[model samples]
Target: MGVRITYLCVILCTSCNGIGIGIDLARYPIDSPTSDEYLQMVNRARRSLAETGCASFPGFLTAEATAEAASEAAAKSPSAFVTDSTHNAWQLPDDDPARPPDDVRNVRMRTRVASTAYDELDEGGALKRLYQYDEFVQFVGAVTSQPRLYRLADPLGACSINVFRPGWHHAWHFDESEFTTTLSLQQAERGGEFEFTPPLRRSQAELAEPAVARILNERSPYRVSCVVADAGGDATAPPVTTAPFAPGTLQIFAGRYSLHHVKRVADDATRERLVAVMCFATEPGKVNSAEVQQMFWGREIDRLHVSPMSMRANRLVRSVFLMLLMISVATVVTAEEAAAEPVPEAKSEAAGEAAAAEASPAAEASPEPELPPLDCKTHELLEKVDTWSIDCVAMWLANLGFPELRTAFTGNKMDGVALKSLTMEKLAEDYGVSEEDQRKKIYYNLKDVLRKDNAAGNTNHYSQMFFWLLPLLGIYKYLTLRYEKQIEKAMKKYKKWQDARNPPAPVEIKTFDDGTNEWTRGLNRDVNLGPKKTKAEKDEEKKAKKIKTPKAE
Candidate 1:
């Protein structure tokens, strides 16, 4: 639902005085900041982004919903404002002839938009402490130090003055860029990830080989616990290790060569990873192939970025198509009477016709929602708690393309913050008592009732004072002494929020065991990662096992 205006804009790249073939773009190494230095860097970055009317912020990439818990929500912001553009990059040609990609390339360019930033962070100015290069070099150097974490991708090659707003699920497919950088001017709630199957590009070739298919389908005998999701804080995934998405911490990745999914992150995980997409590509807008042009208008060789107006119109069509695609994927159901076979209830002769008759319709009440065999729903539940905050997590939900949890309530109570705060004051205006008594009464009433701290399940802003206090107390020298209580409280709130979003379903009470009164229930709780292996997975498995097991009788 973004108010996007797709246009026909050309990538005006500055070719370095006709640099020719045989020259791969030079890469710069991005640096890592010490823990202490990171804190300082974050504060400074925050101030800088805010002044430019930008929306940049920090987030702990983690799965822990409680405050201060490690997370996996790693992202940079300012995506809303960043313009769209195709990254001109390296592409291995197909037999020396490249096949183009499908979809539209809606490009936008962006520049620094943080509030109160240091003046002119360009080539001329260098960090006095690090004592390095000029402003531009220093910035480039900072990002280049860690090629995997901070890729400099600028359209048309050379890093120039630019910025961009990457939309939700910004790039559904892979990119040829070896790595990309972001500054996080504004962060969205969901539907984006810089995921890749590292070294998978090589494995994919092996996987495609006819002989290798059998080996890949076998169920891992040992169900060793693995990371289902990381808010950028958890790095259980192969290669990239660690979770936590700290803003301003530039990210770099070889996207094209990697089988990565820029996941459609749910609202719960959206608030964390806020990156500002910054590119320092040697050749900015040079596409790996003209095939990239085809992505704008699928299978249409004749039509393309011919006009900004036509591109805009085409964007609308694609948007509608995408909407249908999402819905279709979300609601696909199988009418497999075999897989969905129902277990029957038992009836006793002593209870006779009455019991048999009563049990019949009890079984026919409702059918289960036709959903994917995978328990993607459980993952969704875990996501809610994984991305928690004192705030209602509005941004995260929005990012997922889901409506806000409190949308109904907010709409009904629609008052600005000042009005809401003042309402609290008005609620406490009941006294002819002395000034001191009135103030005390209001304070007590407001504290104990509106926002009771000691209450078990109720909460408000007052109760969350501990969240603010613990993180700041002498930097809370002893973790054991403090932070624990506040952390637990925040976790509790997260649990509550999680529960509300995905309430448990009522169970069906039925006859006991075959005859021994051993009650049985089929817990169809979709509580696992996606649907269990579908036909596709089963078919692969069957094909693999066939080689070992006896063939058809």
Candidate 2:
């Protein structure tokens, strides 16, 4: 009953901590401690390492454990010593002849490493527990195929958290150890890619110049791959065969044989990358050399401290050099100013000439046509963007508040002509802009160039108008086109209704009923409506009308 109660209490304690204290066998699988399943996992990892010089296990740490470790590291980050410097891959001393002075292997490294001494960690801390776990050590040894891999005895260099803030990077360098193990706790917002070239340097005397040049020139032929965590019981996500970075994964690499670097993180990154480096050595009590300790940790162990006499000598040399440099700079500046001063004889001659010119009325009457003030707008439009370079387009977009697209354009070599020919679908595919709103923003920003008018103009009016009225015209055209069809339909309906409301008036007709028979007959012939011409003509007409009436009766 007492044993049962002890087990229950242990379970309760683990539950309170939100995760088990030791390696979660479900993920790491040391269940039988010597089971076939565990050995198979180790063998597979070893095989991958041998084949590719690197192996990764995604989700090696439980979610709860990862979170706790990240939190602890963040809390301790304020005390972390930040080192920013440039060094070659071998990290040789300045006097070492083996170190090449002009080799491409000389690269700059920048990073901030936060170290937690083994003695300082809380007894129940996740990192401490993992480091102390017997199964974890055995598992690492088995996977590395090393006869025995022991924990680093150095108090300061054993286990540490490496923090890479925005714009920071790890330079191209080989590791001091044969194998390195790291767990990625977080990732930067963008551009913290991990890249390496295998078999770059075989020995101090032998260096692969072609491969080194390709990587340094950013044109390496080897494909970069990333390990992705498997979720929902699915198989491991296929390695990102073309991308250089991976986050939230566990990796073990034989870095001594591989030349590797972490690409610089972007300046606009929102989060930094956090990684825990668990160092181990084949032999026990092995510590990093004094030079490497100073290079990476910013200080040397007491036993390896430089002699006071040598330090004083170095300081004296630096002070003398600085003093001499300042004096030389001052001398140069004074000489330049004196040389630039106008000569007295030339000044007097120029003054006499000016007075003679002023005395002449013809010369003084009309001043030379004042040159126009520099037109910055025209100059920028014609001289800058008109060059049609990819860099120029990026600058133009950056000025217009679309700086994020600058990288996309530059990467794809999208010059003015290429930008003009790009379609929305193609832009989305090439740039990875999948969001509807962001896609619209990019489309609208480049629409002017994409749909530019190419008709012959007097002075390249398209570029001029694009720089000046593009914003206003874009707004106006969008609004106008949006309502054009609706407005046309409404106008047609109104015209039909107006025509139905007003109709043409009818024609009028009139008739005369009271008419004499003689008059009617005269009307049928040629009626004479005028007064009688003479008295004889009137008497003749009266006689003719009376006879015609008698005959009718």
Candidate 3:
């Protein structure tokens, strides 16, 4: 009995100090820095990062932890904002006046990916806990040889889940941060591999633009490298059938100088490629710029830049406005209700007869009649807008009191197809409707009509609910103001640290030479690490390519 109990304990209890955080401490004793195992792991990571600008530790998390992280991400992924655009390797805008049309910065590539921000993740979840772990931070600092490392303070970009669904791809671009840390939580069924070049830029002052242009123009064997997880559970320079990391792999990469991107996920993939990006900065209170935050998370950095006093003032103004509006609405409603009286049956009949007698023949014989109620039955045509005619859509809009849209639709000859595809930008640019309130009214009402049309028993009572909820908006603003004030106080308390001048010296990065360098020897080779195709499929492709269209004899 004693022997059996010992065996069971040994089998079940595989971790030591990492139990709470779900780290596999037996294999990676990060808490025990003096241990030989810890030293070896750190040295290997440092060496790999120095050589290849990246190092990955597989099995960093236990199996249960990895699954939990993946599950948490999957739940929050529905809210992830889709970023689809075409830009250069530097993530430049489409039209750049600073660079000529033929410049390498003008070169375009398409990327369609989604990201779930740090604020979206559960605060008590495994991924969040791991990111906040002191041991993990210390380990990353040791690996990078930094004297100190601080987690990014950016609310949205501090930690985020990069989700690559089917047909999504991240274009070749460099990160803005000096280094980036990512944990592999899940893998797609096919494609989606990490590929990067070695340090192309030595420093901010000396950017190797020519070398970048070379890779962008010509993906030569000397410039690009493909790292993949091998069967022996290590990241190596060889083709593999899976993604670069198995679940529970932790990768620290110097992505600022090394251009990298995950390959396009295959259209037929059954699963998404999910990676938890854990960010750290050598300096304290570091956060992503407002532009980066907006691009990735579709929001600013918690609006922390606004002063608390100004925020409080704004809140006070909003509260007063809301109170006045609510009082006015209540007064109007009460007056209308008080002005009306229940008519007796005899008096109602008498008034109807009098009203009929007073109506003139010309008024009764008018060609245009009063519009009917814009009810669900009438708006049902909008549910299948493609099948409806322009006249039908115009009549509906006119009944809804949106004559501007009706005019725009008639002028543009915008049929149901165009009406269904109307966007805010279209309304502002193409049409003359510049007022945001009017545009929102037209747009959201159209959506609401469609929604009610499709729903089984939904009615158009949203406007009533909107007025009732107006008071709650003040409450929301007040709560938000209070939260912001607290955050403001906290931020000010750390003002000294945020303004500290002594920053760590930048790490030295070596640039790779194209001609004189031994390109064939190291990890900087363009090896095919994509999904492996069978020999039969390769032959079929070859035959298809060889059999070109025959020209006319």
Candidate 4:
């Protein structure tokens, strides 16, 4: 019983990482194949990927592009070339990652992917080369028949010129397809090994079962590394080996069904590996995830310099003006008559779609900005509390997962100095909390910021307070006096950010009964907040009831 429990325990642990045992399918010691089949396959896959519009690799250029896009690259789902239709291309990372994982590694120096036979596309390009130049395809065919690959065509895939940096190591992960080809464009100074464990390829029994556990728990998993390590089970087994790769060498390997990790480079030399991806799907142009694509939306940013305060203020003013205008018109006139206003059918349909999209499962999972308490006094008091703890608040917001604090409390620049001033002013006040002397002088002496706003564009003291509370209160009451200034500043950054990577979907103007217009983001009225009206107000609203025309409705 003790032995059985030990065996079962190993299986349970392996299951967590998806491994198993006692399986012939996990066979290693594949005496390198001698045929030229894979070379033809590689050439064909390359052509197919090129033929499709959406597939390509990352581009690593300046440090700025590197920082802004690194987190995104790792987060993206693996997308390979398709067979029939085009895909959205702008979402791919601007610069490939410096590491070996597809997110960081350069693919141009390694290999070109080719169309697979299963995709039902005719092979002539890289696929032809995979078989003719080398028996690469033959080696793969001998191992696993009909391996999937990215189809390559001209103009050869978008990123055929990028170079690979040394120490680039692609880690173990399941591939979208069964097989992948890495055509070496360049090698690292040292240590560019491809690693894999064969015991992970079981088909009949779940790889997470007891069978896979014993294999990894054994001591010889590393001995079977066929690419760069000694690939032998016992002392008698032949030492592990790898074929030297050149510009034309086509190296096909089992990826989807195998657990693999590329060895890191030893030196600082940049190694280039330009490999294209190929795959099969239930449909011709199935998408991966909506969140993945949103990353690409704001890539083409406009160069506008706006202070954080101004930006927040602009958004607040615009939102409030629009919101107030709407409420006023509906209050003065009637809801039906306001909606009766004429709108383009295309615009209406687009708005409907945008709303529907926002209401989707994917959208609901995204962050939902909470509206602050409607009472003005409550919002003002909260701002007073938040203003004092700029340091504490900054830390709190950071831990809350808000990415804006990259500079200060949020992204870019945070008005730390301005916060100190506000803290001092509040402390001097006789307000209930600020009146306490034990805390008063402690927060008052810190005025390092007020002396420094010589040309500070974000000199607005309450800018942070504005945004921090807008979602809850719907508007910033204090800054209403600085309306135009705030609006001008925010519009600049919003326009800039929009033009770049995350171009917001174009908005449409929807006019209401009173004298106001609102930007409709094409979202639906599905926010389950319930009938935006009170019963007493509903009765009073009947005196001016307005019926909309069916066409204009």
Each prediction's whole-model lDDT (CA): 0.32, 0.60, 0.71, 0.34
Better of 3 and 4 by TM-score: 3
List RMSD in Å for every model shown.
Answer: 35.3, 35.8, 36.4, 34.2
Better of 1 and 2 by lDDT: 2
Best by TM-score: 3
The parts of candidate 1 lying over 4 Å away from their true place are: 1-173, 189-193, 199-243, 267-274, 282-289, 293-553
For the record, the alpha-carbon RMSD of candidate 2 to the native fold, in angstroms, is: 35.8
Clashes of each: 119, 0, 0, 95
- What does candidate 2's lDDT look like per residue over 279-321, in tens digits? 7889877766776666556665543343455468656665454
**How many pairs of residues in model 1 come into backbone collision?**
119
Error of 4 at 549 (Å): 47
Worst 10 residues of 2 by lDDT: 1-10
Q: How high is each candidate's TM-score?
A: 0.23, 0.45, 0.49, 0.24
**Candidate with best lDDT:** 3
lDDT of 3 by residue, 40-158 (tens): 99999999888778888899999999999999999988889888866666654454567656555565677788899877778578888898787789899999899778898887788
State the local distance difference test value for candidate 4: 0.34
Q: Residues 465-526, candidate 4, lDDT per residue (tens digit)?
A: 56445533543443454587878889998989878977678867778675344432223244
Instruction: Choose 1 or 3, whichever is better by lDDT.
Output: 3
Poorest stretch of ten by lDDT in candidate 4: 1-10
Q: Write the per-residue lDDT of candidate 1 for residues 1-553, one digit (tens) a residue.
A: 1222222223333232101211111221112122345435544544432232112223311112211111111211222123233321121223211312310111111111211111112222211111121222334333334222222221122121122123323322345444444332223355443443343333212221111111112211111221122234432333322212343233444344433333334545534333333333443243323343223222222212334445676666555543443344223343432222224467677777776567756476765555223212211322222223312233223333323233532333422222223232343342122344443443343333323322332333454455435334423444434578888888999999999999989876656544322132233233434323567888998788988898678
TM-score of 4: 0.24
Ranking by lDDT: 3, 2, 4, 1
- lDDT for position 35 in model 1: 32
